[model samples]
Target: MGMNSVNTNAGAMIALQNLNTTNKDLGVTQARINTGLKIANAKDNGAIWAIAQNQRAESTSLNAVVSSLQRGQSVADVAMSAGSAISDILVQMKEKVLAATEAGLTTASKQALSDEYTALRNQIDTIANNATFDGVNLISSTTVNSASIKAIANADASATIDIAHANLSKTNTAIAATLSGLTGTVSAGDVTKLETAIQNVSSQLSKLGTGAKALDTHLTNVMKLQDTLDAGVGNLVDADLAKESAKLQALQTKQQLGVQALSIANQSSGILLGLFR
Candidate 1:
């Protein structure tokens, strides 16, 4: 072969060897640092990276669902506590009326009791009106959170959490003039009127209890769904540390072998150099 041909052949061979060593070392270094066989897009490993990326997107979406569910839980808790307090006041009101049934309560005392009953009702209304979370009130209105997240490249996903407060209306007991024992000619048959008012209050109390129980049910479901989402996210994107560590060890060994192979290739080039001399 001519000098130019030999020189060209040697250069091409050396370049190919260098390229091989460089690619091998690059693979090892990437595996060591990333601890992943595929660090970049799906093009690197079409099947594996594609699955990983899809799983990662699903995990991200589930995380958002969990967060929204958590917020829904908070709203439900506050509503539950406030409802309990209102129920307590209603029980106290019943006790007061029972006390008046035997003891001759003065008109002024009856008026005072009525005023307190009204105040308690107003307080419940206030709680329902003002119970807000992050500038949104759940007790007063049914809020549906259209919480959305763009986790996938070309797909849109959103979730809605319905926040509904239990019915907080008071079980009102209408005042019977006879119950007050005021000097007004309320007919004897009006005794049944007082009983009816108390009955109305009791019936309403039962309805409110049912409503509160339903709200509690919603809260339970929210908690369960949140836990499920958390578990799903963990399964999707969370790294398996033990597996990654094993891969790291293998990559380190590959790196050392790549370096030694490169040295052998350089020695082969030196043999060609001896022929020229």
Candidate 2:
């Protein structure tokens, strides 16, 4: 226990302790630099790591939500495009129906117009059936009845954005069967009915447009939420490389100084030998 005892080197013990401390600090700095993260594991900061892990999970879930929204948006866009095409076809049909109403039309001429109108009507049905995305057709009755597109609004799946299908089938009352019974002879009531059908097609287009807009807004929101979660995770775990680099240099210097001090402490015994000589 004596301070001057030759067998017990107190100065060396103190220097060794300091060197161990410096080595520990240097290891920590090196690990941070290598990983680019201050909180790489729960051992670094348990609470922060837990929060960052949760945020990462939520961000991953948001990716699936964005995908769902995109699919829904595609279906809505296809339906809208089909509706617009149908609208154009209906206008052509109306013109043909008007031509049939003319006074001196030959039987062959009337039949030709009726045939063209029928072809156009059948085209509308074909377009509706084909306006599908990922097997979900918003305009077809058979598919629309079974399609209920819903997007997740949260990681827990507790909330959702629902998109209802719009049935634009030729048989649907919304667009009534005005062209189904058309013949060589056109009536005033048929003209009126065609006018109503045009209005219904317009209404369906407006509805589809509204739904598309809603989907776009939801997609934007999902992207923003994902960005926010990413930022949160970065704040929790990301390291400041510049700061850690500076610490690394400082620790290296301290480690060298510790080694030199330990060498000097061990040499104190040599000084005692010199006194005896």
Candidate 3:
């Protein structure tokens, strides 16, 4: 209470307390600057940290969902492209079959036409078998009910998007079976068979187009969701570097002033030594 006694220096106590407070403030500012996060740990703010952590987890899990969707898209695209090629080949085969059925055609011409048609028909099986992505084929299968491709639609694995297989090969489809029975001398019924094959190929193409579109739409939605989650996490944890920088400068200045104040306080007892002289 009095400058007369060196036993207790009140000014030094106050200055040291202020210096300690400034040091603590400086530490917090430095941490924010170093990490670029205001809530780097639970000690900064537990509730915000927890919320950001959850959002970060969700954003990370969406990476797997994106991979699944992309794989499904590739499979669908391969199937779609192969199916289109098959359709074109079917059209060409139909032209050969029609020419073979002409009334004036010689046996050699008819056999030549049949050979071309057979070659085109055989290509369908090759294309279908090769239409695969990531080891999954959507257009070729020996069984009546081929396994459908499924992709995860959400981060939690609770939902999925399913793409059904379209059997387009000689061993599975009725159109292929009908064409397999053709001879060198094509009949009017052969035209009918090609027509039916065209329609069936068109139908399968439509289905594949629909599935590909659906996958694209869902992928867009999932990507948007991931961006939103990332932004949410940023809002909860990201530091305003500009503000932190300003605060850091202010705290540094305060820290220097605090050290000077403590030095002045510590000299107070020495000043009383002049009284004894």
In model 2, state the lDDT of residue 131: 84
The 10-residue segment of model 1 with minimum total lDDT is: 146-155
Local accuracy by lDDT, each model? 0.50, 0.83, 0.86
Clashes of 1: 0
The segments of candidate 1 whose C-alpha lies over 4 angstroms from its true place after superposition are 1-26, 35-39, 135-165, 170-277
Error of 1 at 52 (Å): 1.9
Report model 3's TM-score to 2 decimal places. 0.95
Residue 232's C-alpha lDDT in candidate 1? 59
- lDDT tens digits, residue span 1-277, model 2: 5567699899999999999999998998899999999999999999999999988999999888888778878888888898888889888888888888888888788788888888988887788888888878777777444375676666688877776766666876846658563464577777777788889878877877877787789889889999999998998899899999999999999999999999999998888877777
lDDT order of candidates, best first?
Answer: 3, 2, 1
Candidate 3: deviation at residue 65, Å?
0.6
Model 3 Cα lDDT, one tens digit per residue, 95-203: 8877777887877776777777788888888898888777788888745334567999999999999888888877656565455523545689888888888889899
Better of 1 and 3 by lDDT: 3
Indicate which candidate wins on TM-score: 3
Q: Which residue pairs in candidate 2 collide?
A: none
Candidate RMSDs in order: 7.5, 2.0, 1.9
Q: What lDDT is reached at residue 127 by model 3? A: 90
